[model samples]
Target: MSRIGKHPVPVPQGVQVQLAGQTLTAKGPKGELKLTIVEDLDVTLADGKITVKPRQVTRRARSMWGMQRTLVNNLVKGVKDGYSEELEINGVGLRAAMQGKNLQLNMGFSHEVIYPIPAGIEIKVEKPTSIKISGADKQLVGKVAADIRSVKPPEPYKGKGIKYASETILRKEGKKK
Candidate 1:
């Protein structure tokens, strides 16, 4: 059996959780999220607690079971408190600004790099080098962050690029001949 999958997910107050057929829905103050459960997985809901079980105790089944449980847990947490990621630009003429719901980035490009923020996600650009992205869905927040980082990943040479607030970019010595 899966250790994490066997545990119970405690539901907080002011939140509603429902398990219908192959779908699991969670509603909270932030927003609502619905997930379709896969086969061979059993989900139990009652009295503010959710539990996950697998049809078989095989290794693969156990892995899936834990992942499913984590997904459900994220859904519940996201709809309640939500999630966010912050990115900082480090380079000359590299800055971010908000154009309505889209991000305008001038990362050494001749033209601005326009990026549209997806639904359920919010992007904010402060004065110079900070960009804040928030959402009620974890996956969406991560995707948006990844897209932004891809524009200009931190280089080991000068560490001049965009990177997560919590990320560390190691620097390499300049070539001297």
Candidate 2:
């Protein structure tokens, strides 16, 4: 038995959830999101709660039980409160700015890196060195943050690069003279 699958996902106020065949759609103040459940699982919404159960006693069905339940929970929370990711530039000249609908990054390269912002995602540069990315989709927000960080990942020696606001760098000692 899956521990997480047994618990039902509660529908918060101001959020509407609808189940149609294999697709589950959630709409709230933030936005609306949809998820397609696997055929091996059964999903139901009742009494302001969503429940997930396996249709058969199979290995794959059992393995996906908890994951599908968590996915449903994420959908509910995402539509209600949304998600966000923060990045910080550590280098001296490194900075970020919003150019029209794209993110312009200056990370010590010869040319500025232009990252086109996707639809439904918002990127803000309150400060030159700090970036805040927000959206209703948690996976997309995280993916965009990671993609931006990959452009200039922090180095171990100087730790000069883009990193998550909550991340820690493990600095390395310089060579002896």
Candidate 3:
């Protein structure tokens, strides 16, 4: 039995959820999102809650039960409250800025790195070293943040690069004398 799958996801007030065939759609103040449920599991909505269960007694079905339920939960929460990811630029002279609808990054490269902002996703550079990415889709928001960080991932030695705001770099010892 999947522990997470056993708990139904509650649809909060002001949020509307609909299930059609294998697709689940949620609409709320933030935005509207849709998810295609896996065939190995059964999903249902009742009394303002969404539940997931395995269709058969099998390893794959059991494994997908909890994950599918979490995905449904994410859709509900995403439409209601949205999601955001923060990044921190560490190192001297490394910074970020917004130019029109694009993100400009300065990470010791010869040419400035220009990243075009995607539709439905907002990127804000509160400070030159701090960035905040927000969107109604949790996956998109996280992917955008990861792409930004991948441009100049933090190094272990000097920790001079871009990283998540809540992430801690494991510094390595410098060259011995």
Worst 10 residues of 3 by lDDT: 37-46
Model 3 lDDT tens row, 85-161: 99999999999999999999999999999999988798989999999999889889999999999999999999999
Model 2 scores a C-alpha lDDT of 0.96
Backbone Cα, N, C clashes tallied per candidate: 0, 0, 0
Off by over 4 Å in 3: none
Ordered list by lDDT, greatest first: 2, 3, 1
* Candidate 1 residue lDDT tens string, 81-159: 9999999999988998888878899999788999988889988887679998888899999999999999999999988
lDDT (CA) per prediction: 0.89, 0.96, 0.93
Between 1 and 2, whose TM-score is larger? 2
Best by TM-score: 2
lDDT of 2 by residue, 100-162 (tens): 999999999999999999988989999999999999888899999999999999999999999
- The TM-score that candidate 2 achieves is 0.99
